[model samples]
Target: MMIILKSKKRQPHQTEKTIQILKDKLRERKIKSKIIVLENIEVFLNEKRVVMKINNWIPSKRSPVYFRIAERYKNASYIFSKYLEMKKVPFIDNYHTFTRERNKLIQMFLLAIKGISIPKTYYSPAYDSRKIRNAARFLKFPVVIKLTEKERGEGVFLAKNAVEIKRILGKNKGQEIILQEYLDNDFDYRILVLGHKTKLGETRTRTNKREFRNNACVGAVEEFFPAEEVPSDMKKISEQSSRIMNIQVCGVDIIRSRKGKIYVIEVNFSPGFTLDEKMDELNQTADYLKKWHEKKY
Candidate 1:
């Protein structure tokens, strides 16, 4: 069986033409396929191998799974891909890429090496008060302390002074963290990039004055814009970052400082804007998958 492991319950009826395209393509190839929602599966990992119980049945090693799981299903994709790797099953968007995307520090380092502009960030392998404090000092009083394995915008923090930094260090003792130079910005841009093309763009702004993050999941207002409307530099940055990371479809978050300097915040491996109305992003991904399946099989 060929499994299309997706994030949504089902593609919407009217606007989901792209999904139908995928279905048609699969049918043409006589590939026995089914779409399974990622959230609906139960994965169990043990000493030697990994297993997944989907509804009342299980897919054997012979079944090839393509991960249509993106955006909010980051953790789920990671776990499932790990299971697939263990079982020596072929899958799209494998475990290594997802594993690397989980670490903010690593992402920043890779982007930086590729000449992508990012905020000055530092990390420590182990918990050390002096090391963390020194990093804060270098970044100045207003520093952003981000959990190395970031969880959306939830793990990001804003520390105004040394006292606050000290408090945060104590609170998250032994936790892998990274310190970044804080950049004051009204809002940040979430630009969706796919197949080296800019597709959808949106600016996220915090509605709550106290909140520093501009995440839609955290009650921030998102004003979306089409590809043409996105700034040229941002578009270039998003494309370059996507190419560097080898993520065909991903969200590249870019923030502009008060002085109008733009910096790449982070790259979201499993970005959620594929089903959007304007761009046929999902269709493009599915097309890629069809070709990949053909080549592999």
Candidate 2:
């Protein structure tokens, strides 16, 4: 069995760690694997024989002049995903999974159609203050702002008033920003959904003044465990979201509102396991991916 793992261009350090762990797991299972870090793909000759490609990169570069070159490398991830379409591969998640997961608004819209409750969300291009202000006004104050394509809780801010929104947009001009209702909850769940199954889930809390943000990237603690028995309806909603989006695996961030309603905050395509980083869970998720790849390939 052949497997290919792709990751973002920057953050080579963290990607290296994940690749190592995955390589070790496949090796332990006596499976042959090929891992490709996309940003540095000039090292490998383009080949069509590879099976199971995992893509983790998002097009977030500064200049469109280099986009074609970057796209060539990014497209290789799709090529590998297509290879899985032809034969039995060890493990892989396709390009569409990455694409839909990267666009927060699109993902939310899909989930909403499947009967999942999400915060009222809107998006606008950069430099359109009037349009953004209008969307914010519609959602009401204390709205959450985010870059349309980002992970690890980066490029996200909560603005209370038009002045703060204007300040943020001024600082982050020339990018797609999403404005959404801020769910009122003290804790959030980082539920790792693998193949429609919740493989490993984590709960994050803001327990200290120094760390106000409840993101593992912001130094918040992560407590990992198997999913608490999710209601059947909720399980169906999660699975349907995954199926509709064609993702083999995802990290679903969910929140509980003041009215005690559950809402899906976001879905991550290439979610990192470092926050939990436990060997057993990693191995299990890897094994599941391996099985899924076997069926697809």
Candidate 3:
């Protein structure tokens, strides 16, 4: 698997055009290749072999893996490259260039750069409490504080104002935190995408009105439906976002603000599945996996 990557500052339209140009170039190429999105690639360490799945298709480590990763995603690429080396898998880019950069921040930055609407977020690596609090104040009241690595809404906190930010920050000192502008929405949609199509959709809502997170871990429930039932715009955005992230399978979490502006909240790399019953979803997933497995094998 060979990866090549690029970027420049331009207007949103220009950026869109550049992406299209890339797609065209990809189609015109004669050699076998694939677009490697950082989020789309899953590498597992706990397994017997260092299992690496790129959009469900396992690539042989014996094949040369090149790096054309973007500036924001280079750190993550470095990480993957290091793991490949540790496993004695062949790949370009070694530990000579490596840093444990924050992945969440880079993921969001990539989405935003691609013109996907996301909440205004601030990042601060500062050790001072006041510096962090000041960054939260820039986003106004009712901000969301998220610990970069924590998932399932565990490290997510809602801060109503500066005081709340202080209180939240005090409790989680030394944690990597990101301050985000809170979009007031009772519920959010999680559209599951595989390839260019959205396989399924669900609306996640908190059981209690006071809770800010719509995570199932937080006593929240999801109402699953077919892909056709999902809003067209939502599905398109989810597919587009997934494609941009180069993730073959992903859950795109989105929200509509009070003003009716749609925003992509998060694109889960390893999204969970919780259905009241398994019928179509199970079959769909099984078939999808089988198709890829057969094609790859």
Model with the higher lDDT, candidate 1 or 2: 1
Q: Model 2's lDDT to the true fold? A: 0.58
lDDT of each: 0.71, 0.58, 0.67
Q: Name the top TM-score candidate.
A: 3
Q: Enumerate clash totals for all models, in the order shown.
A: 1, 2, 2
lDDT, candidate 1, 1-297, per-residue tens: 788876554556652566557877998999878877665554322112334555555766888887765555565566556556656788776543455454675566567656688887655444345655556655676888887765677778898887788788788864656778888887899888877778778888899998889887887787777789999999999999989878877889999988887899888888654334644555555766687679889
Looking at model 1, report the run of 10 residues with the lowest lDDT sum. Answer: 42-51
Q: In candidate 3, list every pair of residues with a backbone clash.
A: 5-68, 40-247
Candidate 3 lDDT over residue span 41-81, tens digit each = 44322112334455455555555565544554454465456
lDDT of model 2 at position 150: 72
TM-score of each: 0.60, 0.61, 0.64
**lDDT of candidate 2 over 75-171, digit per residue (tens):** 3444333333334333333432243234775666456545566777655332355655566666788878887667787888988888888889888
True-vs-predicted CA distance for residue 129, candidate 3, Å: 5.5
Worst 10 residues of 3 by lDDT: 42-51
Winner by lDDT between candidate 3 and candidate 2: 3
lDDT of 3: 0.67
Highest lDDT against the true fold, candidate: 1
